[model samples]
Target: AKGRSATIFVYGATGAGKTYTMFGQGEREHQGLIFRAIPEVFDAINAYGEADGHLEVKVSFLEIYNEVVRDLLQENGGGGACRVLEDERRGVVKVANLAEAPVRTPDEAQGYLRAGIRARTVEATAANAQSSRAHAVFTLTVEHVKTQSQGN
Candidate 1:
């Protein structure tokens, strides 16, 4: 599974349970995709049996409101808007000056996620009481390095 990549995009109309499906609510057992998926990733990494290798996981949360990109984990809601840029070297889109929190456990990841969610833009509308007025993106990056033997 070298150089593997995956993306989970959640989108729908207001009150369509999009937020619930992504973040869930109430009971801990009713955790959403972000919570559930993170643990699975750790489990998979552990199952890989990389005794001498090192694996690191980082998460970044952001929201796009009125074409402005904001970092959910940063202070004062990213302290302003962030720049969306294209990384020529990686050939991927990225947010400039975005904060990426390193997570070693699912609970750690959840903590950052909770903080970011609190910073997200949500409002009460006539149609949907609690409606998110922006598009949120949660990204998880995994970096792994395999240990090399001296004889190799």
Candidate 2:
């Protein structure tokens, strides 16, 4: 189907290589799933070859800290800037007032990802000094619309 969407959920316990698997060790050539996915998305859109169609891609980063949803891309950590709610109209779970960053390139997407990673909630524990205490969710949305030619 054309207008379909998918989600890749990464979950694991503390120090279980979840972060490493999602976002490699920061090596340029040795990136992770997100880096690979970003380019693939752009490439797929480019391969569409729609002359009269417009495609828009946006990225949003959020984290659930102590069950509180926070927008990670916000300047001041976006604390309490958004809330997870069930949209009865859309019949799906949605985040209200989440900030979205329009990205045109994979680099741009990666940049936002880096910033979000830095804004994650991490705490030092006896087992792991820097343990992520929150669940980070990165969302990429793509919208495509075919434009009508003049007088059509």
Candidate 3:
């Protein structure tokens, strides 16, 4: 697992700690999961980068509100029709210009993650106020150089 690509999904009820378990414990004051994991992931990447190779990581943060996919990173805010473009060969769907940031250190990644999370949309329904009205997806793609010997 040292040099491999993976996709992970954190799904659960509201306030279920889905993000916490996947990422890590949230800040002591804020108590959110993404806050914890961003730094950890960045630290891992930095450590790996210092060794034999480097990791090129791209993060895309998004939110689906009222059955509409919204770009969390959009400067104008989200609340309109949006489209998902697919890469046939790669078998992936992505939102255009959805806050893709390249981060090297855990601290930098943490900052970006915090900013993106803050930009996410939340709503208050009859059942639950201060609830996330949409599904949030944070995708991190990591690419590392591999040698033929290691491929064996």
| Model 2: residues with Cα > 4 Å off, grouped in runs | 88-90
How much is the lDDT of residue 151 in candidate 3? 50
Residue 20 shift from truth in candidate 3, angstroms: 6.8
Computed on alpha carbons, the lDDT of every model, listed in order, comes to: 0.85, 0.85, 0.65
Candidate 1 per-residue C-alpha lDDT over 1-152 given as tens digits, one digit per residue, 9 for 90 to 100: 57698888887777888889999885889889988898899888677766778888999999999999999989865568899899889999978999989888888988888888888888898868778889999988888877997999
TM-score of each: 0.87, 0.88, 0.66
| Alpha-carbon runs more than 4 Å astray in model 1 | 87-91, 146-152
Model 1 scores a TM of 0.87
How many backbone clashes can be found in candidate 3? 0
Assess candidate 3 and give its lDDT: 0.65
Q: What are the per-residue Cα lDDT tens digits for candidate 2 across 1-152?
A: 17987887777677887877787767877787887899999999878776778899999999888878899999965666586789798899988889999999988999999998888889997768888888888999999878988998
TM-score sort, best first: 2, 1, 3
Clashes of each: 0, 0, 0
